[model samples]
Structure formats: C-alpha cells, structure tokens
Target: MKRSDLSHTIRETLKRLPPPYDSHYGVVPPAPPEEGVSVAGAAKALDAAQAAFGKVDAIAAQMKDPYIVSRVLTRREAVSSSSIEGTQSTLDELLSVEETGDDGARDVSGKLRPSGGVVPWHQRIDFAARPTVGDTLKS
Candidate 1:
C-alpha cells in the first residue's frame, strides 16, 4: 500500500441567521382547471364520483330527519377520527359525557367533541355540504 500526500481544502460553510427571522404568511388561490379536456381517466373518476354522490343523495332523501341522520353519522365519524388520534371514546359515552359533564368513566370524555352537548347542528350541516372529490380536483 502506497500512501499519497494529499492537501484537503476545508470549505467555509455559511452559518444560519440567529432567531427573529422575517416571515410572511400568505394564501395564494389555485388556478381553475381548464375545460374540454377529454382525459379518459378523469372521465371515469368523475362518473364513479357522480354515482357515489347520487347514492348518498338518495339515502339522504329517504331519511325523515336530516338532523338525526347527521348527528349519528357525525358521531360515528368523530369516534373513528378520535380513535385514529389515539383517543378511544364511544358514541354512548360521548353523549353521556356531553349531557352530565365528564364523570371520569371514559378516559377521553372531556377531549372529544365540544365541551358540552353534541356537535352543533350548524357544524353538522357544514360537514354535509363540504367539498366533494370532483369539486376540489376539477375546480
């Protein structure tokens, strides 16, 4: 093995600036999707979406009380969402906690949903009208 003499040059690295840096927060609107593009995949996806939405609309129409429907659906969704976030709270326990305050029965009673009472009616309505897949992707 032969040892070769090599002079290595050290490059000076730029140091990051100290705290109190300038930051600007701004919202930039996305450009609208162009019309009249005959993409095969997009058309298929749109059709599937319309079909799914039609089924949902039909189910919604059959329900006598939209409020109760929304409440039940929202509670189920909330339970799933909470469980994903590592908080395990069931629908019955959630309702009980909302009615009589947290009695320490469930570990996550206080954390799930609004402080008192079920999720607000307005919030549920907003959830129902939330943007669909085609709406966001197409527009």
Candidate 2:
C-alpha cells in the first residue's frame, strides 16, 4: 500500500498496453490515507494551511475596502489567463479597451490588438464561466 507499490503496478500495466492505445489509458487512483501519506506529513500540511489562512485573514481585516483587493486580484488573474492563451495585454490597456469598447486599440508597438485584448463584458459578469478541460490544457 506504499507509493512505490502503486507505481510498480502502473509500470507493469503500461508494459502490457499496445501502441496508440497505451498513451490513451491511465491507471492512477487516488491513494487512501492509510495507503499513501504519513500522518505527520498530513498534520504539517494542515498546520501550514491554518497559518496561511490566519495571515490572509489579518490582511483582510486591515483593508479599508476588501472589494478593491478582490478587483485587483481578479484583474491580475485575467491578465495571467489571457497570457496563457497567447494574448498580451496589461491591466491598464485592458481597462482602456473596456472603457472605449473598441477592438481597434493599438498595442505599444502600434499594431492591432488581439482577441483577448479586452475581456468581453459578458464573461466578466459571471466569473463561473470556467474553461473546459480541452480549453485549459490546450497546447
């Protein structure tokens, strides 16, 4: 019931799989607590999470407007998400594009803006519009 035991089983199973089909199948089950991790390691991870929560709570308590913090973080995440999709735009540029409602916003290089240049207002209205597995893991 150790990690090595699981790896060994997966390795042997893979050897029996044929080409094309081999890469298509996987046998990785979540390890039960009794099989996978040491209790001490779990305790340490829990303690770390609690400490992080306390620190974030303290910071939130001091913020005059927590909504501003949420807005900034959301904008940052938008920029990062766009970057992952090969769209290069900054927060200020994104805001300007949104304000102007223009697709012709010029980049610093004076070229036409990209598709993700401005997050569509509809997408912004609902943060729950999650990417599908294919969309997220696309090369």
Among the numbered candidates, top lDDT falls to 2
lDDT per residue as tens, model 1, 12-117: 2222344564342222334556775578999899999999878877888888954554566677776666655655667887566557855444455334344323
Tell me the tens digit of each residue's lDDT in model 2 across 1-139: 3336566657555332468676454555555786666679889999999998788778887999544445656666777777667777788977787679776778899988756444753247335544568876893
What TM-score against the true fold does each predicted structure earn? Answer: 0.34, 0.46
Give the clash count for each candidate: 0, 0
TM-score between candidate 1 and the true structure: 0.34
> Residue 7 in model 2: shift from native, Å?
14
lDDT of 1 at 30: 43
Candidate 2 lDDT trough over 10 residues, lowest sum: 121-130
Candidate 2 RMSD computed on C-alpha atoms after optimal superposition onto the true structure: 11.0
Clash count, candidate 2: 0
